[model samples]
Target: MIVHIIKKEIHFRIIKKLCVCFQLLLIVSCQTDDDNPTLPVEDSINGFWFSEELGYILEFTEGNDVVYNINTAGCSIVDDDFELEDFVPSLVSANDLILTTDLNESDFEFTRLSNQNPTCLPDQIADTDDPKVNFDHFWNIFNDYYAFFETRNVDWSQYESLRDQVTTDNFYDILEELVLLLEDGHVSIFDEENGIQIDSGFPKLLETFNMNLSGDFIIENGDDLGDLFGQKATTIVTEYLGGDFEIDERDNILWGLINDTVGYVNVLTMAGYGSDFSNELSTLNDLLDTIMNDISASGVSKLIIDIRFNGGGHDTAALDIVSRFMDQERFLYTKKFRLGNTFTEKRAVSVGPKGDFQFTGDIVLLTSPASISAADLFALCMKDLPYVTIVGENTAGAFSNVLSHTLPNGAEIGLSNEVYEDPQGVIFEAVGIGPDNQENRVPFLSTLDFEEGIDSGINRALELFSN
Candidate 1:
């Protein structure tokens, strides 16, 4: 592997390529069956509630509240600015607690810990250049918390031997090789102080997109494929939607009329809606409400919802947007976590109708490899509905809460520690949510397509609703 300082902008770009999945995760925990005996709501109100998905143990106490970021290496108190009311306490069972947060409508489910314990104390690992220490620590984290070794068909046990040969000189090389073996988009290693970051799956995905969709045309021009693709996607909206649209203040969502009866909504992300976390959900809802009213009033019988360019954000945001299309309550999806050999019970997730107007019209949801975590979740749930037709490529296939940990050498690492599935129990981890309509494949734009002013996805969607 190469040893170099990845640019600061490059690092942020990686973060952008990935999704802000943990905020949705920040709200969920290990959920078990309802048949388990229940505890009185008052008894389970306050204590250490473990969010297995987030790898955080939230200490909800009287007068004092705290959150701890945990991994096998140790525990660090997270300085999250969440308040008491942020977690409106409710009991699904004696051991199961839910926090109805104001950030999104999705409930934060937490499992009560029998005892308050962290993997170990922070600083327990010596802050030195000990390759073996860091190596072991890194491997152990995945051993204990990584949820998809079996699903990805990678042999974790096979990598154990690589530890003996790892050294100061070849540590990063070995690490890079290891990540490539895993092929998980959500798995990443970060050493900010050293400016070293290793992402397991994104490079391969981008390379594939360049080969398949863009035909390496952007690469031939010596421009960044991802960056150029985003610009073309934005331009495609203007090319197809007549260059007139309204966007939220942050530009996270864009909406306009493709035609009189066909309206379009392009969601770029599921998060970053407000200055304060307390009001984030409200800010998002207000924007969606505006979009909803416009669609309702226009009497659009066919709606094209484009999440092809989305970087994953909050689960609540995804569901909230999905809610605008639903006329009634419905089951959305399910998620769970892994504990060594065993797995947590499938926790069913559902969403209900929201806002003043719901567009229960013919819909086409466009997708791509850029559709990440929450974006993948959005596609998975939306495909379950009767009226929604997915008309693009598969999503990014990475749909778990990103769990992070620090090494003894102060290097940081993050990976998926949970599992997410469709409503019928199909795991979409290594494989993303694919389109339901297989025959008419509308992929993201190629450089050639952009040069010629063709927006195949929208054109194909328009054909679906033609009178």
Candidate 2:
């Protein structure tokens, strides 16, 4: 009987080994071609790539410009001039050319551009298409072109696989994966028609709830919260939850009630100059009114200004906000950094010989992993003050701001044009500001308790002020 059992076990082991070998072979068969073909190095490129979507052919001239030649029913049309310096060849097949101005040439893939189908936009999305065949390509693009390339610290291979698996599951799932794939504040996916927005704000803010992106969050297992942002882990619980379930006009993400207190403000960019551009005077007027008339009357001594979602609006906003707190010139905090070859720009806050509203109370500003641009400037200005306490994780640290522009082919590129510094001659461009108190609510997951909760940074602010 023992001899018969041993023979049977050996046969089963052989079958298992064969199954493993077959799986390895199947994976290898599905891999993309890695062979780099040999080509004659050219001095310059002057050729065309076919686009079927816009019904035009884009050709490059040696004079550093791209011109569109319209083709209707395969017939030529009128010509329009364009610029192609930002046009990096999409390497798909063997037909794409990587044109370099400095006499360097490489070959990438070239696909006949498809017609601009509006339905392909994520909101109106329907079925599987060729472009949806891969998320790995987008991941590669993020690694190549993201603003904070070296600092993001993501595992490229894993992110690529994760996004690829969920691109077509549903609307919210795809967006959640995309945000995680590109966590940097500056990196965003935009739709041309709906405008560049993440949260579609429409429905009125609600009260007393737990919400997630997948839809109306169902409290499970005796009222225990399940998934939060994407399909990751169980949610952090909350007490007094209130907000709205609105869709932002931008058509990005679905907003639940828990998303109300966190306002959605996009800086759009942060590369301009001068004090007048920041619109600081206006923001301060509103803030001061909130503190004096609203908060003080409501018996609320503490205030939480959420700048974590801010994407660097203007430098003047930072300076103007700080000016409100500077009682003495010695107490003023100021710093400057060189902006390329132009005049050196002041990055911190100082006493501007003005006080919009002087309140002898404590202030706590909530920052996060995404607070950037002018908002970052504001947090840094209040970093050293006794009355002001910054709560949350470090700033987004996107110090080197960019001026971005779009190409005719719908590809957008940004150029980093300036440098900024913190007080005492310290440059904090790539490096962000660390909070006085490090507490945070992870994006898309933690339910914010307006009353009391461990993960609530706003509660931390109130705690600081109450003490």
Candidate 3:
């Protein structure tokens, strides 16, 4: 249950490489140039830059750079000999710079900082390995940024009692216990150097599939839950799909026909498309162009889009895949970032008819608790469409951009820092996005389902279209 759940397609905004990765979506940086603290500025790239998304204070000097992992609790140097990977500027405005980094090779927009945060100042920087200091930083990181304590029905204060109990020997144990109490799929605490990665969400994710990868997710059997991705793909291809059946090289998408009448497309993930990460959207659009063209040519009257195992990726990729199924524009959902005790203004998100070819036929969107983050966003937007009927179980319900931080001891932590809700202001944080019809609900990889080679989600689509 504690195995670090890493995101295959790294979200550049988080401290992904610092610990491990977690599947996530992106959001606009929370700060503006106007929010910068007033100080002197250099017209060159060598200056202070701040990224609320990455939770880092970046300082660039002659030929060297320094990165300070920051949060409301405190700040600490990530390492004595650390530098931002491939930190070359791609764009520079008055006080803004877009720099490409090794995190998925994505260009990130960073706001030029005039001065450092008070907590990150040299004199105030937390540089000790004290377990209590690390504990304070860890607890405060959540106190300041976690957005779902109320929604998840967990009292954050409950952990205050453990603050006094923290010790160097029990530091990791205490942190792991606190992490599990939060019950968030996006939350993770890790010490890469110590080979310790605690994923609070992995057990539940495995439980949704009835897998025993953690000996606690569901049953007693022990198996790598990650294998289920390939197993599920193999089962669908060998047992149910036909026609131009094919899986892309990246294994992110699989498409074909069900009985050569109903269209079938399973998006295993929303991002990580091609050779170039910077042009990921372009690459995906081109692929979508080809797939939509084929679907149009195939003349399938109905479709089943199975995103049951999509853990998440970029939100853009999620929307790109779904827009091809719409007949018109739709106001999808809204998101708000976590401020101190409250949140920022809600931002509306929408999608319109996209791509040269559109599939306006009936669409059955198969979802499960395995569908998370960007996948949750995909389900939320699709739920608003009249032509699409969501089937299967509810989504994983963790919808937010993951914000990363580091403890005083250099341990990396990530937590949900935003909340996404439908257009009507309905949030599905812990409860998940439910199916429009569950009569067709089926365990995709359960022991019985797997042994019998069953994929009732597809069978349900066939049953619905036949009616």
Candidate 4:
């Protein structure tokens, strides 16, 4: 009963060495005279700029070349070289350089370091396939990059103590225990050959929902859904709506009008929209275009977005759906990342309507504890809209983007490194976002008798629309 959301591709120029390398030469030397005012000045960036927080040193040369040195313990120091394209320099200054790129419209500041050699110490883990080394490397990544230590109340030191007890044969189990302490649903470990080997805290909630129902039951009678619960739930919802409905099988959206006024759309999973992130986003936008156009043409006065069983997906896909309902650009939330051991400054994230078919009518967002990750973010963003009301249970609390890193053993580890907060600066990492109307408890699809009445959540939404 594993539900997977495709991790969003992180486009931070600082994190992507290849993009940074190409952009660095263009950015450092291509400053126009109008931009800088001083022409043909000597390069002030020629020297080592050390980031004590990241334990890395950047060396810029007069030749417009850059070298990056990563200081990791037990592993040989890693260096990356980038050659700058030919360009005339307009100005040079001793002030800290702020690198800006279109990859993310954010400024990365780097200061000059006076120390010829910084005191940054490398991790004691070697860059090898050894189980102990792999384990230590994995631990170090979280220690250095994971942002929600204090917020999640995770004591990473306790896990370090257990390292000595782990053997090659039992290391995977030990690692799972170690990560589960963080309680982050985004954290997982997968081998290229064996698929997912560890999912620390994600399966606990699924277990609570009794996710072991058979597939035949889910498809035939659409019942007994354990983990394959969403399809049956969706079927029940469509039947309750009772209109000429259409299910976009490829996009997994079921849309129709309820009582000739309320437009209903039930989105199952946020993943599988396309093969890749870009294609997926395009496909999602296209689907939204069709849905919004139909709703507009049908003259619906209200809309219902059901994400009760959404297991999350790329954050961009969530934003894509949200954009159709927004009329103006507004700040939705802020994202923060870990630098060294401390969290960095929060960056604002906002979205606005992109297409002509923006829905201005009242919106009812249906959610459940199963609505997670990107789904949680969708709820957070929509809740701020004046016309939107959230119903059903609290959403799955995880909201950070899952970042994947490959170990020397060819196994990949994914973890949440960013922290997202609502407009009021409230963090909902462990505790999910509560609905405006909680009277509607999420009905279990396995035990539901739809003939009796409509889903409590849907009824509440209808009641709100009537009022």
Which digits, one per residue and each the tens of the lDDT, describe model 4 over residues 1-467? 00011243211111112110000112223334355444233546566554433333455665544333232432223333444443333332464544432222233345676644532233432346677777766777677666677777988867776667767788788888777777666777777475446655545554444432233333222132232343445444456666467766564677888778888888766656765433666777788888888998999899989887676766667887888889899999998766765678899989988887899799888887667777888898898898988887678778875655445465656677678899999988877775754465554343343334346667778988999
TM-score of each: 0.80, 0.40, 0.83, 0.72
lDDT of 3 by residue, 1-467 (tens): 01111242312211111112544222222222354433233346576777664566667787666667677777877644444432234334667765432222123457788877888788999977898888888888788778888887788887877879999899999889888877788888767789897878766655666642233323422244445445656677777873248666666677888766788888877767866545678888888888898899999899999888777877777888878987888888878777776766777777788988899888888887778777888899888788888778888788775676667777778788778878888999888887655586655556655566667677777788898
Residue-level lDDT tens digits of model 2 in 153-251: 545445554544554345334644554443433433433442433321001001112332123444332112212211211111122123222222221
lDDT of model 3, residue 42: 34
lDDT of 3: 0.69
Residue pairs in candidate 4 whose N, alpha carbon or C atoms collide under 3 angstroms: 73-122, 73-123, 211-226, 211-227, 213-226
Q: Model 3: clashing residue pairs?
A: 7-21
Ten residues in a row with the worst lDDT in model 2? Answer: 1-10
Please give, for residues 94-197, the per-residue lDDT of candidate 1 as tens digits: 77776544433334456889777645234442356689877877777788788888888888888877889999999988988887777777788777687787
Clashes of each: 2, 18, 1, 5
Model 1: colliding residue pairs: 27-108, 39-94
If the candidates were sorted by their TM-score against the true structure, best first, what order would they fall in?
Answer: 3, 1, 4, 2
- List runs of model 2 lying over 4 Å from the truth: 1-183, 187-304, 308-312, 329-353, 408-410, 429-431, 437-455, 465-467
What 10-residue stretch in candidate 3 is worst by lDDT? 10-19
